[model samples]
Every structure is written in structure tokens, then in C-alpha cells.
Target: MNFAKGLILCGAIVAASANAQLRFEISGVGSTQIPVAVASFADEAIAPAIVSNVIKADLERSGVFKVIDAGRVISETSAVDYNEWKARGARALVVGSVSKLADGRYDVRYKLLDAVNSGELSSMGQSTAARYTRLAAHKIADDIYEKLTGVRGAFATRIAYVNENRANRLYKLEVADADGEGTQVAVTSNEPIISPSWSPDGTKVAYVSFEQKKPIIYVQDLVTGGRRVVVNQKGNNSAPAWSPDGSKLAVALSRDNHTQIYVVNADGSGLRRVSNSAGIDTEPQFSSDGQYIYFTSDRSGGPQIYRMPATGGNATRVTFNGNYNTSPRVSSDGKTLAWVSLRNGDYGLYAMDLATGQELRLADNATEPSFSPNGKYIMYATEAGRRKTLAVVSVDGRVKQRLTTNAGTIREPNWGPFMK
Candidate 1:
């Protein structure tokens, strides 16, 4: 990872390796992981949802917890066998149960315990619709993770991606659970759909559609299933990125000059070009505070990352290490930057601490990187053995996992924010 091949302008769907059904192929290990046990929910075998299973899967996928004793029946009220779990090297234990309510809803309950101290750490229960059982399980996992790891879990969030069906020439914009389950199609067309960006509130998504033989930006409401054209100019209106406050979208438009960055109101008003560079500038991502825009440009000889005031003037180079760097993604805290840098001969994912300038390579052959709400992980599309797949890596580059499907190629993954 020391040299560059060439400048790749378009971020297309790179073929990946996986099955028709989406599954997680996790690899690598963290420097440290908490040892815990997630027991089977008492009487959950009689319910339609296996609460404990979902909780265990979410915790394990995070690479923060090593789950054991998942088949043993346990409930929040059950007596804790501290000696047994402590002998098994368990630092913490989780117990939960799901039961039908008289109102036809379901109640999911869970509790976290300290195996060493033999005391309850936390407990929570939620009454939700029958269909939200999986969501509840994810919520429970989030709680357990926060209690044990001191970091909020992203399991309750969602992901938006483009699923390509090349055989039918069809493209679908879909949103699914964090674990790649419960997919719901938001938009579909025979033409190509690229660069899906989620609104900050998680209620809408803006993307580029080539429906009319050209790229047009459109924003769709996930709740209402209604979409409206946000930017349908004479030229290309692609790479729509939302402001941190969800009031505006910074996009790369070819309407004025050579694909300069522009900021427009979320409702398609007040369109104004922001970049004044002679070379092409695109992929405008807003800083966490919505103060500046991070974009790629060829202004200084080779494609490199730069930033400028969100409203307009004074561009400054941000990526000086690479001759070819693109897709600058600032973490939610505005402390780190993630980008795809050409290294050796392949495009790879890299993260840099803006404060310390310490850079770490997250993955090789990765692109379209998006950060999770908690800033703990970065999800990006990458080529895994010639297949189109989506993978996530911890900011420290310690934990890595791939989400792939044999059903079709899924790319342009945008990890959504946590809902209110």
C-alpha cells in the first residue's frame, strides 16, 4: 500500500464474493474483547421471536463481546449462578425473556449482571408490536453493549444501499436493519442509481438517479414513500450529501463548470456553487459541525482531498499524504477523516486522526465509506473476491466484517443515524 495505480473517477459497483442470501463473514479480532454469556430467553422458544439469539448475534458481530452459554435458559428474575459463570471465565452475563401482552403486543426484557461481583448491573423492558421483536432484541443488545463496553451500540440503526439486479437491468434503493435483515425497497428503476446519502434525521434519503439518461438528484421520504426531485438541472446533479442539520445538501453538479461543488436547500432551493477550483471537484461531504465541505479535486496535480467553507470560498488541502485520495468522510465528532486512498495498486480504506495526524489503513479495495452514528465503525463498499459487497471496520481497524449477498450486488451503502 505504497503506490497509486490511476485515478478512478466513478465509484461503481465492484463485484464481491458471497451467497445469494446476505450473510456476515467476519474476520480479524480486536486487541481486547469482553467475555460474556447470553442465555436463551425463558419461554422464548414458544414465541415467534428468539430474543436471545438476536441479542447474541448483535453482540458477537460487534467484536466487543465473546458470547457463550447461549442455549441455557435464563430470565431476568432467575437466580444467578455466579460460581458457574465465573468458572467459565465470564466477566458479564445477560438474561432476558419475551412474552405476549394482554393488549396483543409483546414485552421484551433483559438484564445485565456482573459475574465477578454477583449483582445486577442494569435491566430494561419494552412493550412493542409483534413485528418489532427483532428491533427490541437489537435494543437490548445495544443496552448490554453500552453497559459493558462504555460505547453506544449501533444495532438499532439502519442502512441504505443500492441492490443491483444486472440480469433484469433493475436497480433498487433499499433500507434494511443494521444486520442486513428486514429490507424495504425505497426506489427502483431500470437505470443506474448511485451515491445514496441519508438525511441526518433518518427520515429521508437523497440519491442520484440516471432515469432520464442523465444523473438527477432526488430526495425521498422513507416514512411516506414519496419522492421529489431536489436537483434536476441541465447537467449532472450527483453526489448529494446532507448537512449535519438536515437543512441543506451539498452536491457535485456539472451544471456550472467541471463538476464543482454546490449547496442547495433540501427542498431544491437556493442552489449556489461553492468550489472555484479549475479542476474537477466532487464528493462534497459536510464536516460534523456543518462548517466545511470535504471534497476531492485535481487542482494540485493529482486527485487529493481538500476542504472549504460550507457556504463558499477559501479551499485548503486536507489530504497531503496521498497522490490519489477521494471520498473524505469526517467522523461525527469531527476528529477523524476516512477516505479511499490508492495504495500499492488498489483502492483501500484509511482513517486519519485530524488531531494527531495518525493514519491507519482500515481495508484494501474499499470505497464509498460511511460512518456509523456513534463514530465507532465505518462501513464501506469493497471488492471481496470479485463480488460486490459491503463491509464495516472499527475506527481502530481492529474489527472487520463483510455483509454480502448472492441474491444480487449491493453497493453504495450509507449507514443511517440513530432515530429519536
Candidate 2:
């Protein structure tokens, strides 16, 4: 049996080991890349390898500057010979040092230098517990990203997902640091948990749970482990997507005898119908501006994505190429949408421009794709035989990586915003 089919029958299956490692590398294809070289910390540094690689990865992922391979670095400190670096075509240089405190904590200090003029650009430092060394590195990356791109970096965020281990009959809702470390099970249950969407505040996650033997929407608080059912109507109360303000949720409900879009307050009050067609109008997602809600509907024919004003306006069709499109996730800026589009007899992750309606495929055999809080990368579900895993793809559709643990089959990854 197919792995996905077995997953439904067995209600969560152990997946095989993933064949990939999640790492960052940039080939620097474009001519517009700012040439930057990051050198490994001195051998005396405390978190030597971790900090250097994390900074390199963060810079490469930013898509603004090209990270020069360190294979040609002439120095790794503020005393770098600018002439040598300039000879190698490096425009910017980064050097850092890490120190382990007496309490076993770690402090990372780094400086940016303008290679051309050989002048100090900026200097910063961050401290973290020994366990959060990776987070400290991400923080450094966030600082660099903001300084360069002027947009806040999401390197310090987290991702939550549901994992199923068929052999052990185990199901767990897992949360991990955005860089895929510090994983802990948020909830463990025999029933399935699906559709984990983060609240705008990054404090809560709204998902569907089958713990009551029926589908119900649940909002789970991360810090306190407090949870309550948001909506548990008679049928198909699935896909709880929070609006931008965290005040309203656009959900799909079948309590009216057909699946339709419904908007209700976060407290479950002011329940109002938003879609009234004779079709399945589900998977409702609110635009970042909150002026409109985009959803999956089949009123025209097979399922296609549509957008309607948040206050209820005439619906507008957004997708025309695929026979099926679902799981629409709008970016934080509301300019792009990442979704699953079935084309050429295969389901792949795609992004569509809302203004021009131009669509681009991001990944193959990918579904249920969710965008990163910063809208730079997308995490989606991919299956091969009995193995299901989460795959992360660059928003520009260039880089891809797969993540899986020996513990279970991973599915339904939802990226959360950077926690303040």
C-alpha cells in the first residue's frame, strides 16, 4: 500500500529515514550579489563551527548577498589585509570570536568590515545559554539580515507540526526552534492533530484535533499548555486560519450541510458566514492586510483558489491553470501566496502573485505547503511510498531541503513568527 494510504488506515506510521541533510549553500548565480566572505572563528572560540556556519547560512538564505566560500579567506579577524581580500573580489568581510563564560554560557562577538575601504562597518555581540548556541548564531544572522535587507529576520522563530509513528502507535504535536533544534513534544495523543496554524502573536496555535472522535478546531497556548476547543460543530470544522490581527479566524464549516467559509472571533463569538455558493468553500486564509480572505472553492468546477473581501465582496478567481489547488497560504506582506497546485498529473507547491496572478511552481510532489513567517521559505509535506517528510523550499523556488527524524512520519509543518 502507498505510505500515505497506510498512514490514513494505521492512523500514523513510522517513516523511513530521510535521505537528505538540511544545510545551506549558495552558488551565487546572479551578478548583483554583494560579495561577502565569512571566516570561521579563531580556534580558541567556544562555539567555533556553529557560529560560523549559521552566519554563512543566514546570509546565503537572505537572497540579497552572496556568501563567499571561505576556501579563499586570507584572515579571520579585524586585522584582515584588505588588499588580499579585495584581490579575491570580496566586497564585505565578517569575522567573529566566541567565548565561553564561567557559567558555561556563551558569548558571540562579531564585526563587519568593508573590504574595499578596510573600515569597520558594525560590531555586535549576543549571549546565550550553552544549549541555545545555535539560537545565538541565528540571532547574529538576524542582526546581519536586518542591517543589510532592512527587513527583520525570522531566524529566531519556531515551527510546529504533527508527527506520527505507526509502529509505536504514537502521535505527537512537536515544536522546534526555527532552525530545527530544541524539539519538544507540545502534545501527545492517540488521535490525529492536523492543520497547525500559528497566531499572529506567536503565542498560540490553532489546529484540528480528533481527540473527541470528531473533528474540532482547537487553539493551544504554547507557554502554558492551556487549550480550548474553538469550534466543534456537527461536520467538517477544519482548517482554522487566524486573521492577521489574531482577533478573527477564517474557518471551514459543514454545520450548514455544506462546507463553507465562516469567520468567527478568536473567542468563538460573532460567527458569520462568508461564502454562500453551492460548493465546498474551505481552507480559508486571510490576507496579511486583513482586507480580504482567500480560500479554496469549487463553485466553478474542480477546486480552485479564490479571494473575497474580508467584509464580504464578490469573489474573484485567482487560479486558472490547475484542476485542483488548495492549502493557500498568503505571505506576511500579502503579496504572494504559496499553495498546492495539481498540474501535469502531479501535485506540487506553487506561489502566485496576487496582483498579476502569475503562478510559479516551487516544488514537486509537495502539498500542504506553509510559508515561513517572514515569507522567504516554505515548508511542505512530501511523500514517497510509505515515507512522509517535511520539505523546506526557498520562496524563489531555488533551494530545497527535507527534514525527517527516525521517530516518525512528519506532516503538517506550520512556521511560527520570531518570538520576542
Candidate 3:
């Protein structure tokens, strides 16, 4: 009856936290990510100092603000002497206190101060269950990110992925809040679901399901629990990638004898070819602008990334580093390309600047990286021992964190677009 059951019969798997008036009033994107100093919260009787570290990690990972390293601090105090923080080149300071609520909850408060002028900029507070203390810290960071960047921080968005239990031969799809809460099954099956991709609008997901014993692509609406077959043609109907506008889907189908990239209507019409390489081509993704289609092809001698016009053009090779590169995804802004690279005898997430052709390594042995809509973060699946879990990291390759529940082997994570 639920979406999760649909996936199991076919094969796959699949909240919002409480409403808080998350008021964000950030100043303009200052000339730079203002340098800020955060003192470690004392009195574990109040809140754990570990929360301070989490907050620091979130701010630093944003690539927006420069946080003063507490490792350099020589004193622990409640009142910040502005000159000390200013001497460390910090323009802002955050001071906070935490207290226990009778309900076994935590009341956390933080105040942002302009170290430059020694004035209060903004203050925010949050309450959370004791187990969610780390999330409380991330919420503080989200408030700061929204205030500064004018975009909501994804610190609270969940990543959905598939997990496999080989012994039982079961596969499960699961979801958890951004801070790793309320993890529940999206779907599960004896078969497998691969390449789960969120539609640009964030209301539905298109994925490859093996419920009928052959790989077929289906689009499932998150709200109505309704699904439509997107592609079920012969010979490997895998890799369903949605276009930026959600008007079309790019997929790899071998119906014509060779696996190649094809574009079709998201509603399952207007099928067309985007790549026609003599060799196998799969994993077709659209550039952020939707002007170009990028895919993996052995047409370049081995699996490598190539780009062509969305309307079809001479394919141009984009990756030159590794002997094999596949599953290329362009960021929302079309500025960076992230893909799995088989280099150094391992598969990891490698990013390349679309304009400069410079590569930045983001993760190790990761697959199916779905970029957040804001283009600031990436969620991908990786193996820890035999189990796969979803790992999220900033675009700059810093601040890596894992989101997992009791369900084992999470794979093929797709971060949905920003949804209210």
C-alpha cells in the first residue's frame, strides 16, 4: 500500500522535524565569509562542549566563514574580549550557553557579535531532545548560513538511499532527516533499485526498479504514492537522470543493441538519443543550464565522461585523468562535475571544474553523488566494510559526515532539491 512495499515487490526501498520559527536575519554576504571566533561551551551541566565542535565544523565546512581555531585559544571565558578575537583576524564572535529543561531536553542559546565593532548582530535559540544535541548545534549553523547566504542551510535535509542485506538477499530503501533523525523505510524488496534520482521539483523520484525481473525505470510521486513507468524497453533500462527543468529524463537503454544515452519525456514520451557511441554509454546527466548533456562512454577508449549539446552534437571528451570514469553529475550551477573515478585501484568521488579542467577529490569508493539544489553540498553512498551508508560532504571536499540507521548497506543516495 505504501511506496516502500511497491519497491519490494518490484525491488527497492525508499521528514520534517517539528516546526520552529527559524528566523534568519543575516547581513549581506559580507565582502568575505567573516572570520568568527567560537568559545567552547563550558559546564557540561549545561550543554556538551562537543556541540561547540559540531557548530564549528558546520561553519567551517560551508566555505563561507573562517572560524577561529579554538586550539589557539589560551583561556576559557564567558565574556569575549573583542581585541583578542580581532587580533586573530576574526570579525565576528559567537557566544552561547546551554541549560537543561525539566523535560529532559536542552535549551541552547547563541548570540552573534560583530567583533569588528563590538556589537550584537543577532541571537537565536533552539530546544531539542538530549539525543539531538548535535543537531541543535547544526541548527545554529543553519541559522547562520541562511542569515549570511540568504539560502536555507541543508543541515536539516535527509538523504535517501538503498541498503542491501546480502545474507537475506533483501534490499531496503530508507530515509533519515538531515541531522539523521526519523529514519524510516521508503521501500524494500527481494529485487534491487538502482540510480534513485529526485526530480528537480522534489516531489517525485525516478529510479530503476527490478521488480519484474528486468530493470525498468519508474517515477514515484512522494505525495500521492502513485507511480508511472518511465521506461521499460528491452536491454538494460537503467540510469534514469532527470533534466534540470524536470521536463525530460536522460537514461541508458540497450534496446537498440548497444547501451547508449537516450532522452525521453519525463511522462514517458518523446524518446530521443543523446549519445550514439559505438561502445557502451550510460549514466547521462544534464548540465545545470540544460544546454549540454554529459555521460560516460567507452567511445573514448574506456569509460570516460563526455559532453554534447542537449539537442545532440559531436560528443567531446571531458575527463583525462583516469582510465575509467563514469556516473558524471554536473552541479546545479554547472560549474563542477562529480563522478566516480577508477584511479589508484579504487573508486572514489572526483570533481572537476567545468571551466578549468582541474580535479578535486571529494570521497573514496563512493557512488551516485547527488548535488544539493544549492550546489553547496553532495550526498553519495559509500561502503564501510560490507555495509553501505550515505555520506554527505561540502563541495570543497571538507566536512564529511555519515547518515545511517539500523537498516544496512545504504546505496545510491539522491539529495532532493530544496523543498519547504
Q: How do the predictions measure up, each by TM-score?
A: 0.93, 0.86, 0.74
The list of candidate 2 runs beyond 4 A from truth reads 1-34, 42-49, 60-77, 100-104, 149-151
Cα misplacement distance, residue 17 of candidate 3 (Å): 15
Model 2 residue 402 CA deviation in Å: 2.6
What are the candidates' C-alpha RMSDs? 5.1, 4.8, 7.9
Model 2 compared with the native: what TM-score? Answer: 0.86
Model 3 residue-pair collision total: 15
Worst 10 residues of 1 by lDDT: 1-10
Q: Write the per-residue lDDT of candidate 1 for residues 18-75, one digit (tens) a residue.
A: 2334678788767888999989988786566788888888888988888887457888
| Candidate 3: regions farther than 4 A off | 1-115, 118-140, 146-152, 403-406
Q: Give the 10-residue window scoring lowest on summed lDDT in candidate 3.
A: 20-29
List clash counts for every candidate, in order.
Answer: 11, 3, 15
Q: After superposition, how far is residue 158 of candidate 2 from its true place, in Å?
A: 1.5
lDDT of 2 by residue, 1-420 (tens): 010001122212122233312323233232356788888765324563467788787677656678886653332354678887788888877777787889877877887778898887777877777767778778877776666667788888888888777676667777776666567666666777788888988888888877778778888787677777789888878889998889999998999999988999998889899888998898889988999999998998788889999877689988888788888889988889888887888888999887887888888898777888778789888884667878778777766666655556888888997677
**Residue 354 displacement in candidate 3 (angstroms):** 1.5
